[model samples]
Structure formats: structure tokens, C-alpha cells
Target chain A: MLVRRFVRRIAQFLIVYGIGLAGLLGLKYVLALSDYVVPDISLILETAKEVIADYIPAVFSTLSVTILGQVISIILAFSVGIAGRKSSWLGSFIRVTAYNIQAYPIVALAPIIFILLGDGFISRLLIASMICYFPLLLSVLGVMAAPVRDIEHFYRATGRMTWQLEVKIRAFENLSKLTTVISGSATLAMAGTIVAEFVAANAGIGYSIRTALYQSDLAKIFVALFLIGIIISVYQGLLETVGTWIIQKTSTEASSHE
Target chain B: MNKKYALFTYILLFLPYSFLCLLIVTHSAQAKEHEIRYRLKWLFNTSVAGDIYANKAGYFAAQGLQVNIKEGSPEKNAINELELGRAEFGVASADQVIRALDKGARLVVLAQIFQVNPMQWIYRDDQPEIKTLNDLQGKTIGITFGGNDETIMRTLLTKAGIKEKEVKLSGVRFDFMPFFRRQVEVWPVYRNSQGVILQDKLTKEGEAVRFFNPAEFGVNFVANSIITSEEMLKEQPQVVEKFLTALLQGWEAAMNQENETKVLAAVKALDKNTDARIMQKQLASTRGLVLAEAEAKKIGAIDMPAWQQTEAIMLQAGQIKRAVQVEKYLQVR
Candidate 1:
């Protein structure tokens, strides 16, 4: 039954995305046809190639930062989240802090961080970490705080070990939210990194975009945005697929017990 | 023996890393400790001769000065920056230093860069609408506030007996092509930059702007003077002298035909898209404007009457109400 529901949702996602993509592609072709009579399509094509090459590195760099940021955030989130959930007062402060940090993206922090840390990977790392960490904290808080009463009572009644109960009850229950937050945070980290680079960077995709903007090189600008979009989409899809497998495995274990 | 070996090995491993950290720190530290700070008229534009020319010629370096060449906003508040001590010196008109002296700021002129005003009023050729100063009698002229170029123009107008109330007013040309294409009729463009550009094109086609030269007509302020605080003049007179000596050398190198390639290369490095020959032509214009007729006269020297005449024009132009004694403002070298 769950498989059927998941498949229907997946189909809906694809249909919506496909229509949007196809419409954009159709519009692009129509615009190209309506261009000046002696079209310099090759010039634009070459420009696109340069832009793609520049973007590939930024996409990869952002992915790496995002992954590091996500991992750190997860560890922090879970630890803080569990403690806060157990203590009602602590939970409110943690929740408020975590929610506010979502707004601390790279553009906001890059300049000050550059001044303090002296501008390089360290400044960028802090920006990415701040953006990525917030989502994980939110996800962790939601699940740990909202653990179904029946599951909690069962664990308490069984006199099961705390760590074991944590893995089975809270972790199992919150897997979907955990995966979603991790993927979202990673993508957000990439965006934050780009904005950070734009302000005080020697080089990066952000720097490339900045220089292009300074000189009014529009082709390169579009190219950078397109490649960033492609990278994020691919990562998101990969995360969701992995998440579905985990969900399927957990469900199968539950069915076996039944 | 084992502990000693471990200690030695650790030092060897960390030695290069420590050296690299030291290099980075030293480099950035050098930037902050620069003795001289120069606020330019524009952010990294090659049109201004001082920043790029000074930087390129190693003139500042020879004076034991590390110049932090910062960008300037459209304000030409270079005088304000000088007064504020955001920097040791700034670039503005010689007339500005004179006017600003009486107004509670003690800005002193160090050296004059452009003796002839490389400043002019440019109008579109198609605009048969503006043929003379009388034709510009009611047109909106875009002007940058607190600048000598606009001040000089207004004075020339008053001398021609044109009233300020008679003409329409607008902001300076923020957009280049639109201004040139007659969105606005009159603007103060740098003679070496936009004025020579439009003139050459028009002259090539045998038509030109009915330009009223400020120097020839009425307003003649010394254009583009290297300025410092009056305090810097008294405190570091020797350092100021050395700087002037270096600048004279730079100007000679910059103006001569033999150093044309070197200057153009420097120009191109600062602005990548600048056309080489056009830039050289502009370079020629810049050199020509810099005491072209007055080279036989003392270099970096100003005549007292010329300075006062320029200031009086500004007063008539209504840029400033107060009079500045030219002798009190000038450093008699």
C-alpha cells in the first residue's frame, strides 16, 4: 500500500517537473528562431561552453562544502535535539536558535567573516555550515520532540536500553525528515558559498559571475546559474532515491514482525 | 634519543607550513601599514592619470609610500576625504583647495597635474537646438556637485551674461550613450575622455560642437591638482618635495613619445577592453592638456592672478560665496 502511494507521488513529481522543463525548452527554441536574421548562434554556443566549464567547478566545490556542513550539522542537531526534547525548557531555546540560523546564509556573513578569519576557505566554511546546520537542527527537533506516545510507552514498558530505543523509535520515525533536511541544507550551503565568494573572493563561480556582471557579460551569467541548477537537481534526486530505499527496508522489517 | 628524534621530525614537518603562514600574514600586513592612501576620482578607471600613472611608474614606491588606491564615488568629494584624513592626500582641482581653505578645511595643493582644463561641455551634433552659449540658455546641463568643471561652466555662462534662472538643470550624466544621443544637451565631459572623442568624430565629418572653452572664455581653474592636508604640507615638507620631484619625472615619462608603448600597456592592464590606438590618442590629449603651452614656465608652478581669477569666477558662478586669499592657500616653493 505504501509502495503504491509513493509511486503515485513520484509520478506527480515527474509530470509537474517534465511540463515545466519542456515549456522552458520550447520557449528557448521559439526565441532562437525569432532572433536577428543573421543569427550569431555559434558565438552564444561558445560562450555557453565557457560558462559550463566555469560552473562545473563551482557546483562540485559547493557539493563538497555542503556534504561537510551537513555531516557536522547532523551530529550537532541530534545531540542538541535529544537533550532539548527531554527537557521542555531547553527545547524552546534550542528551537528558537535553530530557526533563526536559517537566515544566516553566506551573503549575510561573508564580509564580517572575511574580516575576522582573513578570507579564504575558513570564511566560506563558516557560511556554508551556518546555512546547512539550521535545517538539520529543525528536523532533529521536530522528530525527537514529536515521538509518538505509543512508541515511547512501548519502549518504557519493555525496559529497553536508551541507545537502542533511540535508534529504533526516534531515528526510525524521523528518517524521512532527516534525509530531506540533509539534502536541502547541502544545496543551501552551495548557494551560501557562492554568495560569500561574490563579496570578497579571489576566485570561484561567484567571482566569475561578479567579473561577468562588472563587464556586462550576460551569457556567462546565465551559464553559471544553469549549471548550478543542474547540480542541485541531481543531488536532490540522489538523496530522495536513497531515502526511499531506507523507507522500504524499514517497512519490510515492520511487516516481518507482523 | 627517541624523544629527540620525534621533536626534530615534528619541526621539519611544520617548518614549511609555518613559513607559508608567515608569508600570508606579512603580505596583508603590508597593505594596512601603507603610509599613503589615495582616494581616486573613480573606481579603477584608466581615464584618471594619477592612480594608474603613479602606480605604473613606481613613483609612489620610490617615495617610500605604499599607496592604497581606493575607488571614489561620483561626489568629487576628494576634498572632503582630504579634510577628513581618510587619507594623507587626494586629487581635486587647485581651485577646490583654495575654496575649501576658507571653509574650515586646510587642503593644500601639492602639485598641479593638468594645467589646461581637460574639461569641456559636449553637445550632440544633431542638436541644431544648441549652437551657442545663448542656445544653451534654457537647456538642462548635467553637473556633478562640488566640482570645478561645472563651477567653471557656470562662471563662463555668467561672463557671457547668461542667468542660472534662465536654464533648466539636471543631474550629471550617469548613462553615457543616452546623454550623448541628446537625452540631455550639455554636460561637462573630460576633454581627454568624452570631449576629444565627440570632437574628433565631428571634425572627421566636418561638423563640431560650438564649444565655449572655460579657460579662454572666463573660468580658468587649475585642473587635476595633487593635494594633501595643509598639515601634511607643514609636517612632511621634505616628503612632499620628494613626491613632487617623483611626479615631475613621471609626467615627463608619461608625456614623451618614447614611452608610448609602456604607458599604453599600463593603461590596458587597468582597463582590459580599452582600444589601444584610441587610448594613445586620449593619452596624447591628456599630455597636451598638462601645461602644453606653459612647459617653458616653472613646472608645478601657478600664477597668482590666474588662481584668483579662477576663484572669482567660482564666486560669480555661485559655487562658493567666500573668497580665499590665493597666497595663504599656495605653498611658495
Candidate 2:
């Protein structure tokens, strides 16, 4: 039975990859026939490889911003989520502040940040964190503040302390939801870094895109965009995998403790 | 006898008072400085040395105008800012001006700055010699696919009778690693700005760099020029004239050998990113491009033939909807 399942998995993988490869080839052929792209296959392949190789620094720049921003976001989310449940006015005020921050357009704010921080790596980090902070905070705060009525009643009837209820029951109950919100925040983090880079960056894919626009090099623009897409996809995938691992490991520990 | 003396004194006072009133009115009219915003094509650099000099040296102030120089980024469109009335004057290349005109924006060219477009391809000295356009064949040429450089390169290829398949066209970004690593043979740059900086860097690393300027091969794609909307020209022709005159004076002063130190100091004050050494070279390159040809002997001279050729090239490339009477837009002083 195990052998058969393994074979089936391999077959599925092959089929999926086969379809993807076929689609790429079709697109390449169409683009080659048109006036938009260079028609030579070997040249196109070399260009792609060179672009990817050259964009490593940009990839790292993006990742550094995303990782740092997400770390700051997680801390903010937990603090806001826990504290917000204590008082209705505090919750309302915090929510309003978050909304205001999110509402102010990044384009206007980026230049201000650049001026304040002088276009350093730290400025990019701060810009990314600002964008990532709100969504994660709001989502986590909402889930933690409003547990299901049945769960709330059960914990209260059992005479559980507020800390005990939060730590043992509510936290586990919202683990998956928390992970989902964090994953979404990662997406916003990528966008924020790029926007900040566009305003005042010495390096990164955003700078590359800006330079490409000046030269009217459509190919460079496409390459930069393609790399960005791949970076975001990899980020989302990692978030998903890490979230799944945490949930599984925590669930196992809880069951053993019970 | 006392009444006659009083009448004489009152008449003398009235005549002097009238002359004083006339003098005040004329002085105020001449002294009123029009506050106008001039949008630059890019951030503060050697590219905008003249604009900086004009602002810092009180050239605009001398002309009874208060000009605010606003820097632009990749996302900021100077022409669009002009259309929206956010700026009175702006800098744009022939490509941008053509595109704006194609979209029905009534912008006029004030003065062409660079005698030749600074856009060119830079290759290492060790690479194949590119003395002529035909030499680009069988070579890997880097282009920003939708950029003006790409348009120019494509045109060059067509003119040289070289097929696209004959050469390798690669995409490049802001990073010079691809060119350095030999993945791309020729890379694009603004000859007077980034070109000088890149060449110096490469040369320092023991790799000398040479540029493939399109003008050498007879393709003159116009670069940044002083631009303003028709509304401004029609409503405030005097202000426009004063501004242009002062700006031209600023350019002439900036290019003068005696004023190099002042010009460099003014440009450095605005742009703090570039190295002083690189900036000096860049300034020299800028002077060369801005004041190269015979027509450029008079700073800010409008080269009508170049503008016409630029428009024709754009039309041929299908970059615009129709041929614009390019001369109708140029208001040469």
C-alpha cells in the first residue's frame, strides 16, 4: 500500500510539472514570434539566467526587509491582541490608529521617511514594518478578543483564571487563524519594501525597475517583475510550511499533556 | 499778494507728488517676482547642474522671478505634473514630450539643454571594437526592453541592416554585475551622468570602458529640454521670457571655466550621494554635451533640425499617433 501511494505521488508531481513546462514553452514561442521579445531561444535562456544571478542582492534586500518587518509585526500583534481585550475604549482607539496608519498612502509617507531616516536600510525596514504591523495586529486582536461563546462559557464555568484561559484555550483555538493572518502580512511586507525602495534606494529590485523605466528597457522591467513574483511566492510557501509545522507540533504537545 | 504765494507753493508740491507716484508704480511692476515651480526630470545630480546654479546664484531673482526647483523620481511624471498645473515649467525628453503630446497635452518646448542625447551603450575596452553600427552584429547588446535605449538600439540595427537574430539582445537592470561578468556586452547609460561614474569605477578596477554614442552614427534622439504648457506661455509670456533668459544665463555661467568651482559647489549642495571626484568628471561630461556643437556656442539655442529628426524618429517607430508640427512648439528666444 505504501509503495503504491509513493508511486501515485510521483506520477502526480510529474504531471503537474509537465503541464507547467508545456505552458512555459507555449508562452515563449508566442513571445518569440511577436515583436515584443528577442526571438533567440539560447539568448533568452542566457538572459534569464543572468537576470536571476544579478538579482541575488535584490532578493536578499527584499528578504531582509520582510523578515525584520514580520518579526516586529508578530510582537506588535501579540501585545495589541492581548491588551486590546481588556477595555472597549482602548480597543477602539488602537483599531482607529491602525486604520489611520494604513489609510495614509505609502507614496507620500515614503519620501518623509527617506528624509527623516536618510534612505538607509533602516528606513526600508521601518517602512515595511509599518505596512505589515496593522493587518496582523487587527486580525489577531479580533480573534483573541472574541472567542466563541461556548468556549468562553466552558472556561468561565471551570473557574479558569484569565491568563490560564488565554494561554491554554484561546491561544490554541486561534493558532491556525493567527498563522493565516501572518502569512497575509508577509505579502504586504513585500509590497511595502518595494515602495520604499522606489522613493529612496541605492540598491534592490525596486531601484532596478526604476532604472529600467528610465532606459525604456521593457525586458529589464519584465525580468525584475518576474524575480519579484518568484520571491513573493517563495515567501508565502515558507510561511505556509512553518505555520503547518507549528500547529502540528503544538497539537501533539497538547494531546500528550492532556 | 499772500494768496498768489500760496497758489505757487501748492502747484509746485502737486507736480513733484505726481512724479513720485508714477515712479512707485513702475518699480512695483518691475519688482514683482512671479513664484513658479520648475520640475526637474530626475533627482538632484549633475544632470540638473544648470537649474541648481540658476536657483542658487539668484539668476531667477535677478529676473524678478522666484523659482522653486522640484526634484522628480521614477514615479513622478514632470509632464503630467505640468498638465495638472502643479508645476509651471518642467524638463522632459523628446520621447516623453512626444508621448504627452500624443495624449493631447498641449506642452511646448522652451529650450533644448544637451546638444546630443546622453543615452549611449558602454562596453569594456577588452570587448570587440564597436567603431561602427555594423560591428554590433554577433555581439550581445543589453537594452531596457521598453526604454528609449531599446528604441534607439532597434533603430540602429534597422539602419545598419542587421537582423535581430544577428545579435544577442539582453535585458539589464540598474546592477552592473551582468556587464561586469560578461553576460551582457554593451550596457546603456546617460553619457554625462551615470556613464562617467560607471567608466571611472570600471577603469579603477583595471577595466577601461568606452561608449557607443548614437550621434556618432547619425541618430540624434533628443534628451531633456526646458518645457512649459501652452497656457503658461499664452497667459504670462513676459514671465516665461524672463524665466528662460535667466535660466539660459545660469547655464552659460555654469559652463564657463571661471565659474566651475561655484557651479560644482551648488550641484554638490543639492546631491550628496555622488562622490566629489565622480561629480567633477560628470560636470565636465555635462559641459561637453551641453556646449559641444557650433549651435551650442549660444547656450540654450533650440536646434530645430534635431527636434524635427527626433519627432520623425518617434513617428517612424510608431511611438506617436501622428506627426506633430515640431516647430510650432519650439519658442526660441
Which prediction has the highest lDDT against the true structure?
2
What CAPRI grade goes to candidate 2?
Answer: incorrect
What's candidate 2's DockQ score? 0.05
- lDDT digits (tens) for residues B1-333 of candidate 1: 999998897676555555654553354234365467777655554456545766688987788766666667534356655543456667766655554554446667766666777777777556654434576677777664435655666666666678878876553523354354565677778878776666776678677675545666545776666777777788988777876676666666766678878877877887776567668778877777774666465455655567778777666654444686665666545
Model 2 lDDT, residue B39, Cα: 89
Question: Considering only chain B, what TM-score does candidate 2 achieve?
Answer: 0.88
TM-score of chain B of each: 0.75, 0.88
Model 2: per-residue lDDT, tens digit, B166-265? Answer: 9998866556666777878899999988799789888889999889999899888888889998989999899899999889889888888789889999
- For each candidate, report its DockQ versus the true two-chain complex: 0.02, 0.05
lDDT of 1 by residue, A1-258 (tens): 555544654555554444444443443354321111111335346668656765687767766666676667668877887877764677798887777766655565666776666446666666667766676677777777776677777877888748557645887877777777776776776776676666654446765676554323444565676566666666666667777788889989989999
